[model samples]
Target: MRRFNLKLYLIFILVLLVRISNAHQETIRVGFIESPPLIYNKDEKLVGALVDYLNDILPNFNIKFVKTPLSRVPDLLDKDVIQIFPMYFYSAERADKVHYIPTSFHALNPCLCALKENKIPSTIRDPKSFEQKTIVHLRGTLKNRDFLNFKNTNYLELPTQDYYEKSLKMLKLKRAEYAYFADFQQVKRFLNNKKHSNIHCENSHYPKDEMFFVTNKNFYLKKNLELKISKTSFKTYLKKHLSRVNWQVD
Candidate 1:
């Protein structure tokens, strides 16, 4: 009778342990926009440096990646439709809507590109120098406030759905004298392609912007996510990952 009672007790403890472990693991829905080489769909699979990094670091959580439009991210996050969003620049307007991890993981360098054949002067080193020039960029990605320093520059904001192709078309058609990209590495990828050989970017004078992972205001695991990332050597991991993809990380 003593042996039987001991066996039953052990089974109960094991079951309780299993239940506790299961209770701690959660399914976190992560929202992502189409930013190639960082986060984009390929062969029907969502794959990129950020995707791989998150999957590797967050083993305790089941991450479900959801493709979201760039413009709808803030609303989706507010509605609790997605628990987390990666690779977003910090802005006062955005901070009100989401909780930003205290640490920034990457610095995105701005790039101003123009067609080489157009022979646009490379003297445009500052916002003041962009006077009377028409620049094109993704709509939601940039705002009039961003170029407030420019006196009389014209900005043609394209839709975010297929911004990469549209921005390139705008430049090639001479509709815009310059194309502005938030990340130099992303623009470099397009410039490397033979089809876009005419597009060339001059050394940028704009300051680099830091990018961070943001979570919904009420996300239960926000602190846990921040703690995990804080403990990891994310900068080293990001440098290696970017190098592998032929992107320069500074």
Candidate 2:
């Protein structure tokens, strides 16, 4: 009688565990930002290229999401608070620690912005241009390697509290010689607006950079799911998202 009860108790525990797992079904959350035309914020809601992309593809993983500032992502992610990010450039150190699901490197066209009258050479042309220009950018991101060699690049890094809006203000007040950003319509909006005639994009950004996601590669649940989505499925998922975001791709 006692033996029979023990067997039944074990079965009960097994069933209970399974039930708990299914009930929780925690989703692998990813972090993204509000970069208009890429990731935009509206009404305390996030919507844009990255958001749309994830909305379509994330379902495949049975994961949930949380939109957050790019800087905050690392802290949450280091402890596996969240396991994903919409788009990130792969790095050797990150690759060793995080799993980069195969995806397009060149995800979008790039653009550079600066004051119109500030003839500092469109390209930065070379790193030396930084010495003559003040560069403002979203913190916690790698600046373009093209300008890395230049040590004299005067720079102003802002927190998310006042990123783009502050940048616009700086440019308008001629406080910054240049601000680096990549977006089609938003850059156009800034350039076309009468208030921003002094600031404009370079001829255009060249050697367009690529963007993709980074998964901790350490979380077992997310790892298995990410792997289950084959390369073909991943690419197809990405394409569908691109279409949804109205990004032009050949």
Candidate 3:
């Protein structure tokens, strides 16, 4: 009788443990900023290359995406509002706020774009070349430190709503002489629109930079998430997804 009772007690504990584990895996909140082809809303559904990749790789976890502006991402992560940010460029400043998965999923090449009629130089070997030039970019995406090399250059920052296209339009309208973009591939994709045909981007002079998945510092599953991301062929998946949207992966 005592043996039967002990067996039932053990079974109950096992069931409870399993329930707890399942609960923990049920939902993981992921934060995203609206960057087309990477992450965006379409037809009332969250869909994009980064979204598809995360959904495919994390089949076991129920993901809830929280869309926020780029500037608020660090605060959201620090406050534990989200467990993961599926795609982000690495910076020492960001690293202090969140932990990055050691493996990089993609590479980006930064470039300067301007209307062909503007006749900006094709390559920028020296920052002085842009002296007194007016540049536009998405606010919070680029900083004065990024342009520490270029003194006296005018910077016009715009909000993130359709930023890529808007930045190009600003150049076409002569509001800015150049548009600085962090990802050459993203700029290339946007340039496919006939309206932007006159815009030409300078060849990237900087070495390719890698982007990684980042998690809140306090996230409990950071190690497991890192191992999963490191083991997956994320680059291949990203390339395939981007290609579907006519965006090249580099």
Candidate 4:
């Protein structure tokens, strides 16, 4: 009877241990920003290219998403409020704080989006061309810094307090004259549903850059997550997304 009681006690302890272990297992926190086609809010749900890709690949992994404005994403990473940002480009400053996944998910081709009626130069071969234009860009985003490279251009940055949709609206309403920069495909996708034929992307633009997954230095599951991402085929997902978009447009 003592042996039987001992066995039951041991089983109870094992069960408690298992529960504790389960409780302590970290749930990966992936940071999301409002970049249309890549990530955006729809009907209060996170939905976009990156979201769909993550849903397909991370079903078996434990994950929680934190969605915020594009500008705040960098701050959240700096504060370690989030563990992972699904897509990021490398820079010496940013590289110091985060570990970049070895694989690149996509190439980002950013361009100037302006109203066709404005007759904005389709090609931007000469930096001198945009001398006095009231260029508008999303505040605190990659574009803000990118535009600074054009020393000859004077650009006005939109308030970060506002949303990206507002920037598009401003362009549509001709509130800003030119130089609203964004990913060409993303801008095209955004314009598809809108009633604007005047909006078009400039042929000449910033050089293409690759985007990769990046995680904070202290994230617990960093090693395992990076391993899985390395094994995954990013092009497969990109192809699928493109096909879907083409079919929908057709």
Best by TM-score: 3
lDDT of 3 by residue, 6-26 (tens): 999999999999888878877
Please give the TM-score that candidate 4 achieves against the real structure: 0.72
Go through the candidates in order and give each one's C-alpha lDDT. Answer: 0.74, 0.59, 0.75, 0.66
Candidate 4 ranges beyond 4 A from true positions: 1-25, 69-75, 119-125, 143-146, 149-152, 159-165, 238-250
When summed lDDT is taken over every stretch of 10 residues in candidate 3, the lowest stretch is: 241-250
Q: lDDT winner between 1 and 3, please give it.
A: 3
Could you tell me every candidate's TM-score relative to the true structure?
0.77, 0.69, 0.80, 0.72
**Which digits, one per residue and each the tens of the lDDT, describe model 2 over residues 89-123?**
65665566566767543354455566667664656
Per-residue lDDT for 18-89 in model 1, tens only?
Answer: 889878888888988766567666666766678777977787777898877667778989897888888777
Q: Which segments of model 1 are wrong by more than 4 Å? A: 1-25, 117-128, 148-151, 235-250
The numbered model that scores best in lDDT is 3
What C-alpha lDDT does candidate 1 achieve relative to the native structure? 0.74
- TM-score of model 3 vs. true structure: 0.80
What clash count goes with each model?
0, 1, 0, 0
CA displacement after TM-score superposition, residue 85 of candidate 2 (Å): 0.6
Pairs with steric clashes in candidate 3: none
